[model samples]
Target: MPLFRSPTRCIPVALSVTLSLAVLSTTVAAQGVRTADPRASLKGGVKDAQQAIKHLELVSSTPKVEGWFNPRDLGDFGFANSDLAFQKHLVFQGGWHGWQAWDISDPKAPKRRAAVVCQGGQGDPSVYGNLLFVSVEDGGGRLDCGTQGVSDTVSAARFMGVRIFDISNLDAPKQIAAVQTCRGSHTHTLVTDPKDKANVYVYVQGTGGVRSPNELAGCVRSPDDTSTALFRIEVIKVPLASPQDAKVVNMPRIFADASGKVAGLWKGGDHGRGTQNSDRTDQCHDITAYPDIGLAAGACSGNGILLDISNPANPKRIDEVIDPNFAYWHSATFSNDGQTVLFTDEWGGGTQARCRATDKPEWGADAIFTLDVNRKLKPAGSYKLPAAQGSTENCVAHNGSLIPVPGRDIMAQAWYQGGISVFDFTNPAKPQEIAYFDRGPIDPSRITLAGFWSVYWYNGHLIGSEIARGLDIFTLQPSEFLSKNEIDAAKLITRDELNAQLQTKIVWPAHFSVARAYVDQLQRDKGLSESRISAVRGALDAAEQSSGGPRRTALTALATSLVQDVAASGDAVKVRLLSGVVRELAK
Candidate 1:
C-alpha cells in the first residue's frame, strides 16, 4: 500500500517494481560512465539550465574580510587580462579593451573614474607619480589608439611597445610617448636610481613576435642579426621633467653565454623527465626589482635569474637557475627580508586547468629558494593550491605579492580560477595556505579561460584583477589562524604606491600591535608555554602603559629573562627578535 515499492516488501507487486527499478538504475549508471558527451562527465550538469547553478560562491572570513566585484564593461571590449597599478586613491585596471581608472578611496564601494576605449594586448600597467606606463604586445594594437584595429603587418599605425601616459588628469589620460621595441613589452619593471633623481628606468621585457623594420626601425627578427634587440632586454629611460622624451637607453644582453652568443638558454625540451618541457628563453616574462637592495629577480621563459641592478640603466645577470618541474618561469616575488625569492611556474600557460585532480601537485606551483651570502640561489621546496579544480576551469599560478605581516613571510597569490590563495612561506621548506577566496567555474560544461590574473596587496586591501569578472577588492578578516592584531600590524605597513614587480622591504613600527603580532605567531606555533605567554603579554602591556625609565627597565628585564629561557629552549632566533624589540622600547 506504500506510494513507492520497497525491496524488503513481502508483496508480489513490490518485488516486480523493485526489480524493474534496479535494472533501470544499472542501465543509467552504465550509460553515464561511457557517455559520448564530455559535458556529462563534468562535476556540474552540462545543460543550458545548469549554467545558472552556482557550485562555489563568495567564501571568506565573513565581516572581517569583505569583497567587492566590479564587472568589466568598457563598451564592447574583451576580458580584463593583466596586472594592476596603484597611485594615491586611484587603482588603474588594465584589459585588452584598454584601461580604466577606479577610485578605491572607499575599497568597499569602488567608483569608476574613467574608462579608455583604445584596443590593445594584455594591457599590463605600472604607475609612478603622475606617469602611467602600459605594455602593448599584440599585432592588432594601433599607434593612433584607435579601436579600428591594425591588419597590415608593416603598417605605420601598428603599435607594439610600451605606451607612456600623463595621468595628471585621470579623466583625460594623454599618451605622452610610445617606445617601440624589436618585439614588444609583454611586461615591464619600473626601477628608480637613488643617485640619479632626474630620471627613472623601465626594464622592457618583450615576449612576443619581433616587429618588422617597416613598422619600427632597428627591429631585426633573426637571431643571426648581431645588431638585433632579440637577445637583450630593452631599458627605457623616462625623464621626469620631459615625459615625452622617454626612449630606450640600454639593451643589456643579460642572457648572453660565455662564448658571447646567447647560448644555453632554455631550448624547449622535456629534459628527459616526464615533466612538461621548458619554453625557450627569448625574453623575461616578469621581473621583481628591489631598488633599495639593487637586486632583481627575473622570471624568464625557462630560467629563473638574479640580477645586479646597481646601475639602473644596465642590469647584469648575477645568477641563474633551472628547475625540471617548471614549464615556464612566470613570475617572481621577494621575501620581505630579501633573503628568499619565490618563483612561479605557469605549467599550462594560464589557460588550462592545471590544478585538476589528476595533475601533479608541484607542476604549476611556486618554487621557493634562499640566497646565500654570495647571492647564489638554493632551491628550498614548492607550494601549490591545495584545492582540486574541475576540468572546466583554468587554474594556475599567475601573479601575487607579499602581505607585509611584520615578522612572517605571507603571500597572497592569484591561482587563475583557483582564486586567491594566501599562504605562509616563512619556512621555505614547508609552505601552508592560511586563507583563500574562489568562485565557481565560469562554464560548468566547457572549460573557460577566465579568472584572476593578478592579486596584489596595495596599502590595506588585497586587489585582484579578474580576467572575466573584472576588478575585485578583498580585506583580510581575523580568524583562528590570523589574529586581529596581526591584521592590524599588516595594515600598519603601508606604501605610497605599489607595483607587484617592485619589491619593497616592510618595516613595522615598535608599537603594541607589532608586539601582539609576534605573540599571536608564538601562540599559533605553540613555541611558548601558556605561563610564559601570559608573562610576556603582561610585561608588554605594563611597558606600553609606563613611560621613560620605568618602561625601559621593565622591557629590558623581561627581554633578559626571555633570552635566557630561549637559550635553554634552543630558540636563539626568537631571543634575538625579542631583544631587538626590547631595545626599541628602551629608545
Candidate 2:
C-alpha cells in the first residue's frame, strides 16, 4: 500500500469554527476572495474521519528516466507565473553556490539550457515577470578565504542578499542587479500587486547566523541586548519595471507583539533553540504571498505567521500558528480557492541537531497540516506520510503544492521519496489517500537512478525531479483524456478473455491495479519456468553466503538464460518478469 496519512505534530495552520461556512466559501467580490481578505476572518474545524471523499485517481507513473537530474539535493520549485500552464524553468542552489534553468516547456524531458555557478551557499529562486532573485551569502560578501578565517569571513559577509538577473532572453538570462538588504539573504519571495499597475515587490529574508566573533565565542547571548535576528522578517521592495527604486525596510515589527517580541511562542528555551538575542540565531525559512489578498504566509522555524502587506512599506501580521512538535516548519502552499493553507515540516535537523536519542518515525520527520484562515489563521487538521510506525530519518517532504482542480473537493501533493499522492479533503480533518505512487525501494537500475525529489504539472503532464537522476514524465492515456473519442462496445474484450490474455506490459490507471497485475503474473508465470527459476534461486542462495555478493552478476546470467527459454517457448510473460528484475539488479 502507498504511504498517505502522516503522523501528528504540535501546531495549527488556520481559523476557529464559530464564524460560519461563509469563511470556507470561494466567492470573490470587488475586494478579492472573501476568506482570503486580510480583514475577513477564516472559520472552520477539522473534517470528520467518516467523511472521507471517495474515488481518487492515479493517472500514471514513468520510472524509466529517473537518472537525469544527477544532483545530491533539490530545493524549491517556481513556475513562470501564478497562472502559466507550464513551468518555464527551475533553479536550485546547494553544495556549491550553483543555479541551473531548464526548458521545462517539455516537462517530462526538460533540457538544461543554462547554469550559473557560485562558491558559497545559494538558496531558492524567486521570479517576477522577467526578473529573478537568487540569494547569495559569503561570510560578509568578501572574496578573501585565505586571509581571514573561513568562519570569520562567512560571519563578516553577513553582507548576504539577493542577486538580480534579467531573464528577458530565454537562452541567455542576464544579471541586471544584485541588491543587498540587511546582513544576509537566506530566502526571498516575489510578489505582484494586481491593483497597482504591473508593480512587483521582493521580500528578501535572512537566517540570523552568528554575526560577530563575540557571539560565536559562546552559544549564549545576553537577554538584555535585543540584537538576535532569530525573530526578524525583513522586507525589501523592488519595482518590477524600475530597478533603481529598490529600498529595504524592516517588516518584522508588524508581527512583533507590544513588548517587541515576535508573536511566536518558543519551546526548548534559549539554550539549544536559538533566540534572536541569544548567541545563536533563529531561522525564518520560507514565506508565500497572495498579493490579491494583501496577505503573506511565513513558515517560521517553529511557527507559521500571517502578515498583512496592504501597506507595502509598513506591513502588519494579523495572526499566527505555532507547532512545538515539528522542529522547524519549512514550506507552505495555499489551496487554489485560498480557503486552506498546507504546511510541512523539515524534521531531519531536529533529530540530529537536538541529539534526541529516541527512534525516529517511519516517514521520518515530515507531516502535512491544513489551516483555516477566515477570522484568523487556525488549525483545521493534520496528516502523516508512510503508514509504517518508526522514524523516517532521511525521506521527508521537502517542498509540495496543491494541484488546482476547478470544482473538485480533493487535493494532490508530492513527497520526495513517497512519490505523488492525490487525496480527498472534503473531510479536511481526516484526509484520506485516493491515489499514490512510491518510487518503491531504491534500485540502481531504476529510471533516473535516484530518488524522486520534486513533482509538478506542466502542459498537462506530471513532471518529477529526481536528484542525481533525470526527469520522469507521465500523462493520462489518450483514452483517459476528457475529449477522447468514445469507443464502440463491440470492440471491447470480455472479462474472461481479458483475464486469460493479461500481459505484464498492459498499462493501468492506478497503482493498486498495477501491483495486482505484477503479483498475478508472477504467480501464473512461475509454473511454466520451474527449472529456470530453480536455477536462479540456487544462485541467489549461494551468493548470499559469499563474501562479496555476486547476486547481480549471477542475475544477469540468469536473465540471459531465461531469454533463451522464452524464445524457445514463445513465452513473453516470463521474459518480462526476468528482464525487469534483472535490469534493476544488474545495473
Candidate 2 per-residue C-alpha lDDT over 1-587 given as tens digits, one digit per residue, 9 for 90 to 100: 01111211223333322221122121101112122221111121111101111122233222212222232422212100001112234422221234555554444455665555433333356555566566654453423212232554324333356767676675776666666544456566666556666455666666545454342332223333465444565667776668645656554554456576643343332222221111111445667776655666666665666667676555576766654345456556665455666666555421111111232331123333344435365555554442221122124545544432222233445444444545545445545554444433233222111234445443344455444333455442222211111111101211111000001011112222222233233333353355654565565455444433475676566557656666554346545654554545454
lDDT of 1 by residue, 1-587 (tens): 00010000000111232332333233223322212222223333212212211111232211101122223321112544467888878888777778888888877677778777666677889999989899888778888889788877588888888999898888788998998887887788988888899998999988887887877788888877677667679999999999899999888988887677874466656544354576667678888899888899998877888899999898988888776667788889999888999988887777777787677665777778888899987776577776677787778777999988877889999987777788888887667667877666766767766667888887878888777656778888887767888888888877778887887668788777877787767767776777787888898899989998899899878777777767554345655676677767667
Candidates in order, TM-scores: namely 0.86, 0.58
In terms of TM-score, which candidate is strongest? Answer: 1
Query: C-alpha displacement of 123 in model 1, angstroms?
Result: 0.6
Each model's lDDT comes to: 0.73, 0.42
Q: Against the hidden true structure, what lDDT does model 2 obtain?
A: 0.42
- Identify the leading candidate in terms of lDDT: 1
Candidate 2 stretches with Cα past 4 Å from truth are 1-97, 137-159, 181-183, 208-224, 262-264, 267-282, 350-374, 389-393, 440-452, 476-587
Model 1 alpha-carbon drift over 4 Å, by segment: 1-77
True lDDT of residue 182, candidate 1: 76
Pairs that clash in candidate 1: none
